[model samples]
Target: MTHFIRVLEFSNKEDALKNFCGSFRSGESDFGIFSVDASTFGSLPSSVFAYWMNPSVGDAFSRFRNFAERGLKAQVGCSTKDDFRFLRLWWELREPSDKWIDLAKGGRYSPFYSDIHLQINWKDNAAELEAAILKKYPYLGDSANWVLHRESDYLKPGITWTRRTKSDFSPRFLPAGCVFSEKGLSAFIDGGSRKDISAALAILSSKPCRSLIEVQLAAADKSQAGGVANSYEVGIIKSTPAPDTDAEVTERLAELACRAWKQKLTLDGIQESSHAFHLPAALRDRLGSFDPPAIEAELARIQAEIDAIAFDLYGFSEEDRAPAQASHAAARTDDEETDADDEGEDEENAALIDQTAGLLSWAVGVAFGHFDWRLATGERAAPPEPAPFDPLPAKSPGMLPDGAAPFHANAGILVDDQGHPHDLARLIEEVLARVEAPVPEDVRRWLQKDFFPFHLQRYSKSRRKAPIYWPLSTTSGSYTLWVYYPSLTSQTLYTAINDFVEPKLKEVGADVTALRNKAAARTRDDEKQFEALQAFELELIELRDTLLKLAPTYKPNHDDGVQISAAPLWPLFRHKPWQKVLKDTWAKLEKGDYDWAHLAMNYWPERVREKCKTDKSLAIAHGLEHLYVEPEAAPKKTRGRKKGE
Candidate 1:
């Protein structure tokens, strides 16, 4: 078997072992080579690798629950304004939604209530999901019994390492928290303190260590596609040497790793307040000042320093470092190949759009009173309450009158004190300003052209598309109404038309009439005026007809949501657009472009599949037909007793 030994590539082999000392001695070193082929190497006994590798809990569909952002109440994780959507909660039917509420567990005081943790069914019974998981994969045992107890495993003192069972990517070590390990990946639990974990990660990430691992894996038989020949079995990992238990070195390596990880959290815009350690004063003082490149450079610097430490631990001579250098160089070349990903535009643009979607969704919630006003607008001093049942005379001085709170419960941006809904554009502008992001140029044009398509792509997942906002429109693009999900009903369609479409049609009709009257009054041959008048008349006719076409969906006592099937809401903003809209949305969804499972269309798959024939296979591949739909049991048959009778 071919072995990719680091020493083979080194030009200078002398003086390599003079400065070397085995700290942990987890592996056997024969001569200058660390080979698993040696009899004693794989058998080197050690406790550092005694980890409880969690089992694969099947596909993400069965174990992962992602809440497409419904409202502020559905938001979860340590996400900050920048990466707010990094973690979103799965809606729980039992969670309170009638009044002011925060998604934070323990009502905002719990340290980790807002941070993302390993969770199943963010809005459902987690225990039930766990039970089902064990029932199907009983080999994982009743409790996934491993080398150590799992009583406080989530919060246990240890480092966590993740390796894809089938991917070619290098392993990654993350700060241990609540995370799920499914069939594709192996997670090593129970290392030591956060610092110890960092040290372990540093060693494993070193060039020599990675080279040794790659050789071993390549020598093993390839069992899966898109993966190396060998799995990162516990034996292979255990046989890799660990840095000697040097407290000072461990602490320094840990500091660098911890700092780098913290910077990453910051770069992603996760809320710093959610983490246990406060950012150094220097970093905190310059909040929002660091850019992506700067953060990346700092992280890279830390990694290089750790690599240097690993060299000393493994006693690699100057000549033996070529293999490690070559590996890094190859990684760099791969990155360069894909450097033109977005035509050299800022990748943050995508992040910004994603964040914009989140903000708009949050605003919709605030408008409908699904979320507390203070959560978005920031908390303010409370208004004084009225004295309860005081028997004071009306003439009493210095007494305040009984009054309501500053903000009404369930109040939204759509309507005002007079119960009149504002123009959709006006409400959106207010929401944009509240979130502090600039409204894209030509906000209406943006929505008409780009936003809906982007939104469809964002939520296009099987059994998961829960769009909280629905757009109702006529096929001709002659009229449109945007309605909040929580407030939608058949009556809402009628009310929106009455409030927006009907009034606009009347105003246009009056304009056309006046134009015709002026043209009639003018005796001179006014060719331009006649032409303009003709155009206005045509527009008025189309608008009136569009309104008529939409009226049926709002029939009284009808279940508009069920009957309409979002029919009046199509051709999305115009007729025949559904062909491209459904095609593009379904294609991207099938390709796994979107992250969450909340596409509004997924709820009614059969209707869409029947309506759009071209993308049927794509839809089916994503399991749309059976997703969120129950399977019918086979019909029971009874035998006929003809001869006996």
Candidate 2:
């Protein structure tokens, strides 16, 4: 009987070509069919498990060193165990902080280059963070959840990848001076080795590594939920075969990878959220061509070179490379479908939209005094262009110093109503006029309707969604008041009510009354006008009442963060998804799920104060350490004389 099974999926049962320990035929699919025998497993290094698939594939493994056996070993990054208390977007902090260090959390599909926007509370090498985590987890070293590990490798240059991903196994070259998160796994080369970092990155991020990792994920991953996603965990990576880094091929791959990384960062020069961000690529004042297509073309060329050289280093001939190449081709198609980095932009006129929206958002930031307006008109020198591996900047290049912003929204309030002095549309226009850029014809409508959703998408990372510019609007969104998050206080909502909503309601009321009391029998147009005015009047009244109802007790604390602070006003958020997120967060806050939040102390002082006695972290978080009472040591009892020993 001829017996042949698929090496990956095991579908072929007819053709038995080879029967040795390491024998297989490339199937029509991207995997191979192999004749399996029980004796073949004895020749492999890994457990008689799924990672090797079948013996023919395992033979490939036996010939090479896996990551576990190589100089570089996959290392799991730290888990905050409580992200909200320990992690924050870099821009959220107002100034350069020694307390917050660069954190490499998994971002989008970009490879070779890195995108690290998060900063962790690694103050004093995370002394307080570990203490806080230990207070909660208690079984820190013994259990699954750990806050800190491998402290010696914290800031060393290594490679990183998303532990959980819907896309294929993609990795990036992480430079020195950053701590990686659990979801963002790291694999560092042993510092004593002669292995080059850039060369290793090129090899590991190539098509061969991606396909091999995909095979492992297909067999072992269930944490990716039911989707086409997978968890690229430590065990799987440590068991994968490592390609031989031939010295000549290694040098070429290193050069190309570094070039690719640099070009990729250059495209991000306009990206406000990236470490490489300096000036908008669309800015006319910049001296170079910032063509997206050109940048993309160069990156593709560089990647092609990297992949070809990587295949050579792996000792693959044309036929041997075929399946991996096919697999990678399919992975690219899948990545395009799930690319959230570009906001699902698939040849969807993305660049034009990005330029328009990013410029407008930056303008809004300038109005809030978050960014320096002087740079838009060349009044101040623009910061020098950033390189691929510059130390993370203290602040984004053109940001105004912390307190130097003069035209920040008055009382932390800006209204959307036309003719209002603090109208957001006017503020945007003033900003653009300085740069001599033409304002969009529908700019006001865009701010009211499109801007918040886009801003929410832009600022969100690692499951933390907090848009700094919040729009507390009426039911129909005809009127919105933008509240600058940094300047927000408990009284800011009161300002929105007394200064903006109340005056608008008064005008709406007068218009409604004037229309109803018209002497002439109302024309059709007048009737329509009367109806709108009446609806507006009622809506304005309802919006005002809701704010007044909450004002007496709605004390906001910024340490609770923009999301939690705005959560109390969830009903006022016109964006339904944002409203729902805030709504759920509010529920969590009320239910003690967010007890670490300072707002919890503000709302439920007794409960938090009581917990302060038990959970020292919560005590420290609330600045209520004085309330903490350490549990008394158990009575020594003198060991009861051990029954006369």
Candidate 3:
């Protein structure tokens, strides 16, 4: 009884003669009929995974794809070989590190990082862009580029791609797959029964097939030491054996896989909703309620059920099932733990964050004249439509620094010379003051503490790097402040100084003087109140002086054209390069001694000088001028009390 199995490498032509002789010899022998070839089916090459190997320009090819806003599209929507992972399958578009130009669009070039590069809307610019890209990357003009270049027509309903090669040969399913892929990512697209293909996709995406792929395919490149470098060539992939296509079992597998894919899409949908600053009240309530966790738990259960079905289909034994079951269990644990961490006040906080974010959005709109005073009365028909590069209106009711009372004016006030509202600061203050508790107990405090954190969480999924309200601050975070999108304009700063800062200074000065008089009349019993007022007075004085000094330097220079911060234009649009800004701004803004100029100009030069001046002034005021220059002695060590003492 000669028992020999042939594991033929389907794509390797050199193995054909060897396979033929082995098969003939086996048939000639007594046990010839017992010989079986495990990999006689389709291989990976039978699938469609094309790479656009273009000329690598020195850094110039790196331009259009970047971590910043200068990318060809909103960002480089490509997937690299390293991006795909089991179950958590998705592509992360990246910015080009090397510089590239978009000649047609007056942009730079970028080497292919993903297979899916063309946009559905890029049809108008396709020929021009294609010509320019091919000129710079002539090699990309190969016939193979046809599929990708003509992707709009080919991008169908059920296309998918697999990682060409991976450390683990476990299949990664991309239901919402891209049009093209990098060299190591292979895609699958052909006409067939939708149900059959979906079932096959699920079976491939599941774990049982992973064990089969490893046993039949050739080892990939020996590049990484001590790591399994497995390859999934088209020939070998197609050669993977399976039950009959029309079998009842195959239908069941297809149904399970489709269900799992749908569940994954649900999670993606949830994440997409949270990406924007606002969440619908219904979604917010559901997320805060019992729905989200329940859905997550149910999804995990479904995946486990699929794993069991796959085991039976693959004829995996108890021992083989051990690893697969363990993998499924581990994944379930991770999902549950994630759910547990997100429970409790998470939903409430998310809802509150959304509400606060809406308020901030409204304020920005008002500041930019996109919104009118009707927002205050809750009579605004719809949120203001945002435009990135357009000039702001001279004065919407909420945006005016001063204005006349129009007919039916709810908050009666006279109009300015420009026929706008007077006292922009007053409107802002009133709007903020009227905000009820918990939505934001204190708007300023909320902005200073929580807004950035929430924004980070919201945009984390998209990996957006820019922020609408850029923060400028010192390295130490001891001084941080905000710059609204419009405020980045050279003109807005000038307007703000006269309309916003000057009036604020007057208000602070008035409060300081009132506090000073009260302190003068205070008795020993009122020391705490007197000290509190004095501290506040000092802060106000510093703010007043800072604004006064910045007045001359903050002149309008519309040509500087709002700096880099205004490029994103609106908060709703995607932004990047915001993380660093947010980090520095939050750090500085949290400190009591931080500068406000950092907000006006994205620089902080006066931080050290101001701190020195503050220390010197404080020392002189406290009659400790000498001590101020000297390092203080270490505090005396305090002894712990004995049990009785």
Tens digits of per-residue lDDT for model 3, 1-645:
233433232456457556656776666543212333223212222321111111111111122221112110111122211111100111111111111111011001011101111112123323322433433355653332442345332223232333332233333332231233322233343444556555665665556554444334432212221232234544445545443334777677666665554443333322312211122222233223425466567666765666677666555666556654443333322221212111112222222345446555444334334334343444433225322111212222233233433222322111111223543223334544543212344454444455555544443321122223443322323223344443344354345445543554476567657656775686775666556545644653454355455444444222112222232222212223454444444454335223212232234334433443435432332233453354355688999989997
Tens-digit lDDT track for model 2 on 1-645?
233444322234333323322353333422233334656555444444343243334455667788767777677788787787788777666456677888887755668775687788776577557767777776553343345774537787778887766666778877678888877888877862323667777777887666566666553332222335567888888877787776676678778878888787776666766565555545634535677788789998887888787666556667667767766665555554443322222222235557788888888888887677776566767667654445667776666756565555477788888998888899899888877777888889889878998888877766677678989888998778888887877788789889999888888888888888894888999999998888888888889999998787788765566678888899999898999999999999899988877677778999988988887677777777787787765665664555667
RMSD of each: 15.5, 5.9, 21.4
Per-candidate TM-scores read: 0.49, 0.78, 0.43
What is candidate 1's CA lDDT for residue 322? 68
State each model's CA lDDT, in order.
0.38, 0.71, 0.35
lDDT of 1 at 375: 27
lDDT of 1 at 120: 28
What lDDT is obtained when candidate 2 is compared to the true structure?
0.71
On TM-score, who's better, 1 or 2?
Answer: 2
lDDT of 3: 0.35
Task: Assess candidate 1 and give its lDDT.
Answer: 0.38
* Predicted model with the maximum lDDT: 2
Q: Please give the lDDT score at residue 453 for candidate 2.
A: 86
lDDT of 1 at 578: 44
Error of 1 at 382 (Å): 21
